[model samples]
Target: MVTDIIAQAFVDFIRRVCECENLWKAHAKDLELAKVGDEVTKAISEGVEGEYGPVTVKVRKKLLGRREVRVWLYGNEIDVDALLAEISKARSRAAWLLNDCSENALLETLYKYEDRYLIEVAQRNLDKVKNICAGELPRIEFGEAPAHVVEGVVKGVRIYLSGHGTSA
Candidate 1:
């Protein structure tokens, strides 16, 4: 049962990162269009196909072909960098939990297969996993998986909208 939870949690982390990647890709495309003074609002909305749940976008057309785009996830304003950082941290914690639980022979033997929602199952079982381990878990350094563009112009429309360099 515990191993099942661990696997589910690992999968959830992976899926969440995938969703973030989708969002980043949308940002890139929209920003590129905005840079060229093209209509970006429609492009932005069309990019998000509701796969990651409710994502809201607010775009303002500024003078001289500048645009300001802001995004929200589940009604909370989000900074792409900050959102990625938080999700990465959560995934790391989940990874540690999964690792520690998988090391237990008894727990490994008791794991059962299920087709239920994996993330919900993992979240529900996480506390139980910690109790089962009942000891300090060694820090597991994933060493930064190749992530979304971490900085510079690719982040969002900020650079493109600010008229910082040669226009596209």
Candidate 2:
């Protein structure tokens, strides 16, 4: 029936969002490794009118703390616009799916997603509070990087869903 089809579509949308989050998290981890020692160089030559130069920059391998770990390559200048666009598309799809469902079903789905959002937010908040209370920030080892990015994706999707237009 139409209801079954709509339910399936919603399930598929959720699956796709999870897959994208995983993909982005993996990509972020790779980028963290790659960005170490990334270099930009500037060449400057004296010109008659003024200084004319090409700017180049270089990055060195730096230890990143827990706070720095949150600053991943995923939201960096390189692909953030594309990432946001993709999230917007997902939100639009979720909204359209909600429209297709009956009011009761839509409300159920919204409640479910909202619960998931709240659980994730609480977990993150607890982690931050624990860190602060412990007086030790989480350390970012190579293995810990992807989870941070995945958490970021969860927060982003939650924000998108809870924001102005999508609210129940």
> Runs in model 1 with CA error above 4 Å?
1-69, 103-168
Query: Per-residue lDDT for 64-166 in model 1, tens only?
Result: 9767656665578887455444445544544443454333422333234332333233344444333222232212222332222112112222222223232
lDDT for model 2, please. 0.34
| Residue pairs clashing, model 2 | 38-59, 39-57, 39-58, 40-56, 40-57, 40-58, 41-56, 41-57, 42-56
For model 1 the TM-score comes to: 0.27
Error of 2 at 51 (Å): 25
Writing each residue's lDDT as its tens digit, candidate 2 over 48-135 gives 1111111122223356621111111232433323433444454454444434432343234335434344333333343332232223
My TM-score estimates for the predictions, one after another, are 0.27, 0.23
Clashes of each: 2, 9
TM-score of 2: 0.23
lDDT of 1: 0.38
In order, candidate lDDTs are: 0.38, 0.34
